[model samples]
Target: MHSKRIRAILAPVATAALVLASGAAAVTAAAPAQALENGVARTPPMGWNSWNTFGCNISESLIKQMADAIVNSGMRDLGYQYVVVDDCWMNSTRDSAGNLQANSSRFPSGMKALGDYLHGKGLKFGIYQAPLDKTCAQYFNSYPGATGAQGHEVQDARQFAAWGVDYLKYDWCSPSGTIDDQVRTFAKMRDALASSGRQILYSINSNSVHDKTGPRRNWGDIANIWRTTEDITNEWDTGQTNGYPMGIQNIVNVTVPLASYAKPGAFIDPDMMEIGRGGMTDTEMRSHFALWAMMASPLIMGNDVRTMDSATQTILKNANLIAINQDTLGLQATQISNDGTRRVLAKKLSNGDVAVALFNQSGSTTTISTTASAIGKSGSSFTLTDAWTNATTSSTGSISAGVPAHGTVVYRVSGGGTVTPSPTPSSTPSSTLVSAASGRCLDVPNSSTTNGTQPVIWDCNGQANQRWTFSGQSIQALGKCLDAPSGATAGTKVQIWDCNGGTNQQWNLTAEGTIRSVQFSNLCLDVYNNNTANGTTVILWTCGSAANQRWSRV
Candidate 1:
C-alpha cells in the first residue's frame, strides 16, 4: 500500500528522478535521527493541514485566510496552533542553484514570507516532502516528474530552517523496497533537520506496505508522528482498498490496534481528519474526534475552517475532550473488552483518572455494561463525567447505559470515589445497539460516520454503527435518541432524534426479547417484510410470534 501512496515535491530539471534514484548520496547506516533540544512537540502535535480539503489546489491567499480564521474563530484559543501545507506546494523544477521552489504563481510571497505571516499571527508553519525520487502523488498519478531530498538532504533542511519552517512531514513515496533503506533515508533527513540549528518537529511517514510486514523500524526515535494507515476519507469502517480513499471509522479501526506503540514524543498517526466535510453524520464526526483524542493522535484537522458551522466548530474545540487528548501523561487508550457485540477501551491518564469509551458494535439497542476493574481500575465506587455532554454521574463497580446503533459513550472516571466537579457533555454513544431479528444488528447506512446518521439493519460485522445501548430509558445510537416520529402510525420509520425523554423515545424490552414502544404497546418492533439482508428498514408492527418479531440479544 505504501508503494501506491502518492504525494509531490520539487527537483532539478536534468534527469531529476534518475539522479535522485542513483544512490549517489544515499546514507548506509540505520539509526534514529539526532533530535533537537527545543522541547518541540512534547505531546502530540495539534494543527491543521491542506491535503484533505484542497489537495493540490493550495495558494497563499488560502493559507493566509486559514491562519486568520483560526484566530478569529477562537481555534487558536482552543490550543490548535500549526497550519501545515501538505504536498504539491513545490514547483515542477527547482531554481538554477538546485533549490526547491514554491510554485511561483500560487505562492507569490515565497515560503519565507508565508512563514513570517503565520508566525506573526502566533501560529506555526509546516511543510511536506517525499524521501524518494518522487512522491506518492506523482508516482501514482504518473506525473511528468517529482522531487525529494535524496541528493541534497542537508541543503533542503537548511533552506527550510532559513524559511522558519517549524514542522516537516517526510513521506516515503516511491522509496526503496527494503525497511533499512527507508530508515536510513529518514535518518538522513532527521540529521539534516537537526544540523540546520532550528527546532523542527520531524514527522516521518512509514510505508503502509510495510505496516504488517513483520517487525517495524524505530520511527519513534526520530520523528514526532508516524503515519500508521493510508489516507482517511469521510466514510466509516471500510477495509476495502482499491488504492482508494478510506473513511473516518475505517481509520479508527486501523489505528486502534497500535496503541501500545504510541507515547508522549512520538505517536501513531492515522492521517489528517476530515471534519466539516459534510460527508459524515454529526455523531460519526464526534466518534472520530473522540477516538483520535483517545489515541493521543496528532489532531491535524483537514477541512475548510473558514466556513465551518457552529456544531462543527464546537466538536473540534471541545475543551474537555481536548484536555483528555493533551493530557501531560500522553498515554494512548487500548481496547480492553470485546464480547462479540460491545467493545470497551480505556486509557489511564496522568491525573489519576481513566478515560473509557464504551463502543456498541451491534445495531439494536442492547444493555452494554462494564465494571471499573475490567478497565484496569481497582475501586468499588467511581465518579463519571461525560466528555461531550459535560454530564456527571456516579457508578458503583460497573456502569451500564443504552447506546444507539453505531454510537459511543466516552466518560472520564476518577479512580476510587474522588468526585470532581466538571462541565457538561454532548451526543456520544455509551453502548452497543443490537437487533433481535436474524441475529443482525442496527448500523449506520453504508457505515456512515457523521452526524444525523440514520440507522439500518445489517449483519453483525462488529462495526461502529452497529453499536447501541439503552441508557436513561431511551434507545440511543450515534448519540441521537431513537424515536418514532410524533404520533406516527404503525409501519412508520423509527428515526434517531434528539434525546428528550419523550414517550416515543422510550421502549420496553420484554423477557421474550420483544422491543415494544412504551407510547404504543400494541405495536412491536419488526423488520420490514421480514427482510434478513442488510439495510432492512425497522418499523413498528403488531406483536406476533413470527420470526421477525421475535427479538433476542445475541
Candidate 2:
C-alpha cells in the first residue's frame, strides 16, 4: 500500500458541537465551486508530484531525474507536465535580509535553478505552503515569529514566482479562524502572482473532503485548484485509509469526492494521484484516471512520472476521457445517487451532450437500470452514447446496463430534452451525519443589498445571492455574509458579517445535503431561534429538524 499522509490542518470543531447540541442542522446556502474558465476538464490532469514515491525524501537531483524520466519515458508527449515538489523543501531559518530561503541541504542549487531546469525541459514547477504559521511539517512557520518580517506574505509568493514557479499548493493551517483568512491569504499570492507577470497556478489545501461549508466566493480568483482531502496516504492493508484508498477503493473514494467540485478551470483536486506506486493494479489505475476525468478533476499524477510503465502511459493517454474533461463547458455532474458505491457518473459534454457512467461495486456484478426520469428531468428524453463501447442508446424514461464487480460503463447521452430544475428535496431519517463545516455556512437572505452588514437567512425566496452556490463542493453565502470572529471554530459562535467571497464564506453541502462544517462534520446546519426569532444568532447545532433548524431547497 502507498503511504497516505493525513496531516493537513483543520479548523476547530467547537462551533459545530453547538450545531449538534441544538439537534437542528439545515443548509440554506450550499453549492459547488465555479469553473476556472467556465470550462470542464477534458481529462484528469496528467502530471507528476513528488509525494507518492519520494515522500519527504525529495531533492534537486531526484526532481531533475524525474523530469528527465518524464521526457525520456514519453510522458510529456502524453500531456504530463508540472514537476511538483511536495513538503519538506522549507528551511528552519531565513536569511538575514528577511528572505525565506529553501533548505540548502536538500536543494543546494536553489529552487530558482530547479525551476530553470524544468522550464528548459519544457515542464512547469509547483511548490507548497500553508496559510497558517506552519505547514504540517511544523518546523519553520512560513509566517515569521516575534522578530517579524513584512507580514503581507505576498513577498513569499513573489519569491516562488521569481524562481519561475507555475503552481502553488497553498495549505490551510494556522487557522485565522475563518476560511476567508485562509482564502484571502492565497488571494495575496494571487495578486502577487498576477503582478509578477507569471502564470502561476494556485492550489488550496485543506483536510476534509466531505465537509459542507458554503462556497468561498471569488474562489476562482484565488486558486486554480484546491484539495478536498486531509491527506492521501499510501495504500493500506486492513481497514483502508480515509477519503478513498488507492486500489479497489479509488473508484469509491474518488467519485464520492468528485460531485462536490468538478467545475471548469477550477477543478476539484482529491489530493495527488498515487498511480504506479504498487498499491493498485493496472485496472485500478485506469479506474482512477477514468473517475477523475468523469469528475473533471485536475489529473496530477502522484506516481513517479519518470518511472511510470507502458500500461500507465496507456491509461493516462485515454484521449476520449481527456477530451471530455478539457472541454470548454465546465459544467460537472450532480450525482443522481450519492450512494458512494452502486454509483453513476455523469457530465455535460462539449457537443451539448451529457456523458454518464454506471458503476456496479457490489461483490457480485449487478445490472443497474436508470430511467430517463431517474437519470434526468421528468418531461425530457435523451439519447445515450456509451463512450466506453462507442455505442448510442436512447431512453425516454430511464436507461439500464449490466456492469461487473468493481467495474464501470461510461456513456455520452444527448437530446433536446428539458432539464428540470431539481425538485425541492425532503429530509431522510439520516443514520449518519458529518457536521462541523470548516468555513461557517452563512445562512443567506433572498435580497439583502448590504455588503458589509452581517447576513441573515430569510425563507428560500430565490434571489441570485440568496441562492448560494458552490465551487467544487464548498458552499458559500452571497458575497455578503460574515464568518464570526473572522475564522469560526466548530462550535464557534457565528454572527453574520459582510461577505467577501472568501473560504470562510463558502461551504459544501454533503450528499445528505446537511449543512455541516467544512473542516469537520461534528457540527450541523442550525437556524436562528430554532427557526424561531428572526435574529436568534443562527449557529451550527447538531442536526435536528426544529422549524428554525429546518431548511429545504431543490
Candidate 3:
C-alpha cells in the first residue's frame, strides 16, 4: 500500500502511512458550520458502509435499503447519521461523448434518486472514489496514466458533489508517488467541492496519513478524517492482512501521534472498526471498541448493522463509552500500559471525569489491578462509577481490574480535584521543564545530575527545571518521557527522556494495578522477587500481580 503525498494518515510502523489508499476523492460539500462546532467528528462516526454489508455488489437500490434500515432502526438518532457506500460503484464505459455513466443494470434509478431517498430520511449519504485511476476492485477510477498526470480526476470529484453527495470516502489505491502529490490531488477535489459549498465529510481510506511523516500532511484544513491503516475486512476468515480491521494494538500505536491533530474540523480515523466482524472474541470486540472510544478515533463500523445481534448492539450502544466520545472537552485518549492480555488507555472527558479502560486484548480472561493515579487523577482511595455498567462501583484505596480476554473495564472516574493536569504549553514548546523555582524530579536516577547528562530522582529543592506534572502517570515536563530505569537506550538504561510529547514518551496505567512508561513500553516494574522495599531495584519486567510493582501517589 503506497501512500500519496497528501495522505499523511497513520501507516504501519514499517511502511509508515500510505496516504489515501482508496475510497477517498469524494468531497460532497462543507457540512453546515454548526454540525462541526458541536464536536461531530469527536464521537465515533456511527454509520454504515457498503463494503461490510454489500461489498463490491453495491447498487443504488441497495444503498436505499441501508438508508431505510438506518432510519427504521432508530440508530440515526443514536448517532448513525452517515450512510456511506464503499467501492465498486464506478463503471468503465463512457457515453458517446466520454461522460461517466451509472451502471444501468445495477443502479437503475441513478445516484440522484438514491441521494433523494437518503436525504429524505434525514440522514446523510457518502460516496467513494480513489486518487488512482482505478479502485482496488480493478474497477474504473481516476489517476495519472504513465505520464503521471490525473487524466479525469478533478472532473469526477465535481460530478459526485453535483449529485448532492454529503460524505466523501477517498481512497489512494494505486497512486503514482508520494503522499504530498496525493494531498494536492485531493486538494483539487476539495477545492472543486468548495464550488459546490456542500461541506462534505472527507474520509480518506486508511494509510494516507502516516504519523511519522509529520503534522498531518500540510492539509491546511482540507480533509476531515484521514485513515491510519490499510484496508480492514469484515470477516476473520480473511488472512491477517490489511483487511483484519483495527485491533487494540493498532489503536494504541496510531492514536498517540494522531491525538494532537484532532481539532474542530478534522480527525484521525483508525479506519473502520471491526468490532462486529467475526474472528475476534466478544471480549476482544469490547476491548477494541473501548480503546477506540477512549482514543476518540473515528468509529465507522465494518459490521452488518442491519443484522446486528443484541449482544453486538449492547456493545455498540454502551452509553458509557459513547459518552466518553461525546464528552464536550473533546480530548482524545492515549495508551497508558499493557499487561499481556490487559491493556489500558485514558482520556479526560468533558463531563469532568477521566475515562479509563482496562482491556483484555488477548481475549482470554485475566486479572489486572490498575491504579487510578495512572489514569490522570489524584488520591489514594476514592469512589468510582461504571458508566458503561450504569451503576456505581466499590471504591477502595485502589481498583481491582479483572477483564475477560478481549473485554474491557471502562470507568467514568470522578473525585475531588486533588490537582490539575500538566501545565498548558506555551506558544513554542521546549524540551526542558523550566520551573519558576525548584521541584522534585521523576524518572531520574535515584540521585544524578549533570547538565546534558541524564538526571535522576531527588526531592524538589526549587530546581529551575524539575517541576512537572505526571499527567496520566506520564511526565509532562517539556512534554517528554522520564523513562523507566535501565531503559536508557534500546538496552542501555531506562531514564527519563526529553520531549515534544511524542509517542516515544507516553505511558498509561493498566486497570489491573500496574505502572507503564509510554516511551519505554510494555515492560513493567518487578520488585526484586516481589520484595517490598523503598529501593527494591525495580527491574523492568512484564506486568504481574506482584505487590512491589504497584505504587500509588497519595
Best by lDDT: 1
lDDT of 3 at 385: 76
Off by over 4 Å in 1: 1-3, 6-38, 142-146, 208-218, 239-244, 417-554
Better of 1 and 2 by TM-score: 1
* TM per candidate: 0.68, 0.64, 0.64
lDDT of 1 by residue, 343-381 (tens): 667777887888888776556666677777766677687
Q: Candidate 1's error at 251, in angstroms?
A: 2.3
- At residue 430, what lDDT does model 2 achieve? 12
Tell me how candidate 1 scores on lDDT.
Answer: 0.69
* Model 2 regions more than 4 Å off: 1-29, 32-45, 139-152, 173-177, 208-221, 234-262, 338-341, 371-400, 414-554
Clashes of 1: 52
**For model 2, what is the C-alpha lDDT against the true structure?**
0.54
* CA lDDT, candidate 2, residue 552: 36
For candidate 2, write residues 1-554 as lDDT tens digits: 11123332434333233234333434333343554441222334557887667766778999999999888877777677878887778675567865677878789999999999999999888886655555645533322221211263666766776898887776654323345445556666656666665666777664322222212233554566765433554442113323233333433333343354555557666567665777655655666666666767677777776666778777776676667666666655555542323566556666766666676645567786665554444456677766555677667757678776656677766776535324211111111122232223234332232333344443222223334433343333322233434545444554444433455544545444455555444555565444333333456655553444433333
Per-model root-mean-square deviation over C-alphas: 14.5, 12.4, 13.8
lDDT of 3 by residue, 1-554 (tens): 12322323332222112111231211122122121332235445667777754557667877787677767767777777888877666565555754455667777877777777888999887877666556555522222111111455546656666777888877765533445566677766666656654556766653444422122242425576666544444332222223234334533433443454565456666657676677666766776677777767666666777777877888777777777876666666655554223556667866556777776645357776666776667765566777567777656436557777556788777874434443222111112221111111222331122112343333322211332334444543322344554333322333444433454456665544355656567565444455432232334566555554453221
